[model samples]
Target: MGQGGSREFEGGPEGFPPGSERRSARQAEEAPQENAVVPTVLQWSQGGQSVYVTGSFNAWGERIPLRRSGNDCVVCLNLLPGTYQYKFIVDNEWRFAADQPTVRDEMGNINNCITVEDQTSFMREEQPSGFFDNNQNLYTQALPDEITLAKEPPQAPSHLWCLPLNFPPLCEPHVASWTLLPPLGVTLTHLLAAAADRSTNTLSVTQRVRSKFVTMVFIKPARGSAADARLGPAPAGGQAAGGGFALPQLPSTAAAVAAQQQL
Candidate 1:
């Protein structure tokens, strides 16, 4: 299991490292575009079945009560700009999508995946290198013995969980039986992609996050009615404060222009 780092990264008070060369390079690269501010309603047809949709967004419901929306077990989530992994927990059994798959959990369960683009949900305020900070942490965390990367792409299945960003901390940490140790000097872009890939394939950690790439929800596929499922209003769950994957120490300050964005 990866433990939390005691010290923040040492850049400066504003937490942005000082430099123009790397900043300029990042500007040159193409990142995914932001499509909307509010999350568009996402719908899927399990067509007349009760599928329990759960993930880190919902504290990995010990039993996630699915929502009944007509014929589908509809769930809603508000996510930041990034990738997240999820799966369908159908009829009490965990399963990943048959397409677009990746790795397995510490308990040896595989998961399905989804990606929410950059600046989607949590960009209301400006914070430099928000997601990228977690990207750098992947390199620092100690790797478990079980995780390994797949040689090919994975599959995905469909179900729904209406996970909120402020989901409670999972009491039990989801582990990766087959984990991947990232190589040295990896960038945030590649790190995010890799974490997303892991969500499809590995067991989850207890830490909560909302990227399209990494989440936990895999269940057995069966035919049934979602209408039979019961769900009360979600607890007053709040969104995560941006703690994700592994994190390096935060920088102590920022450059002048970057510092001004904080005001």
Candidate 2:
């Protein structure tokens, strides 16, 4: 009698009966099956030695290679309903899908765009707050053992130049000349002409000074024949200096002289 009582107590409110345990085990096994993700196919029809897809979905960090299916390369992903931007790397060259929508990323490169929509919101609640919360773990689970994620691509180098500013007196009569020494292999014809003619107010001069290799510009007072007196005596090189006025030496280069002839 005591054995019977002990058995009944063991299968009480918090416990399952003998056969019920097996039923619960079967239910646990089937739970994941019920929540299984539907596969979405992404295919690239172009032929290449190797192809890959990388995008914002995986923090734009991991590259997922595609397998050849018939004439096309394809990849299957179980993505939640959302917009994603991606680009393909074919044999190491990056490209966008031909027929799909595209947009320029912050770096100015065009990327293919995609939108995933779930037929029902049933799986939405199961997803975490952010899809990439643990990007490494998510990527591991999303890809099969055969597929490998690629290393992050290197970024392009950027160049920026900052020029110093020198402002002359606004109301005072003055002459300004500027000399530009461009970096090696760079030419500044239009730039130099624009800089020299900016204060001249002569349209014809601007039109004439179109040399592509101009390196210097000189500006003088437009009015008054006594400009030399206002600027003081010419230096040994026949260039005026001092008294807030400077006359630059004439350009020596044949290309420069021809450009100056127009002014």
RMSD of each: 41.3, 25.5
TM-score of 1: 0.26
RMSD of 2: 25.5
TM-score of every candidate relative to the true structure:
0.26, 0.32
lDDT of each: 0.39, 0.52
Winner by TM-score:
2
Off by over 4 Å in 1: 1-44, 47-49, 62-64, 69-71, 99-103, 106-108, 120-263
lDDT of 1 by residue, 200-228 (tens): 32222222122212233232111232421
Worst lDDT run of 10 residues, candidate 1, spans 157-166
In candidate 2, the residue pairs with backbone N, CA or C atoms under 3 Å apart (3 or more residues apart, or in different chains) clash, namely none
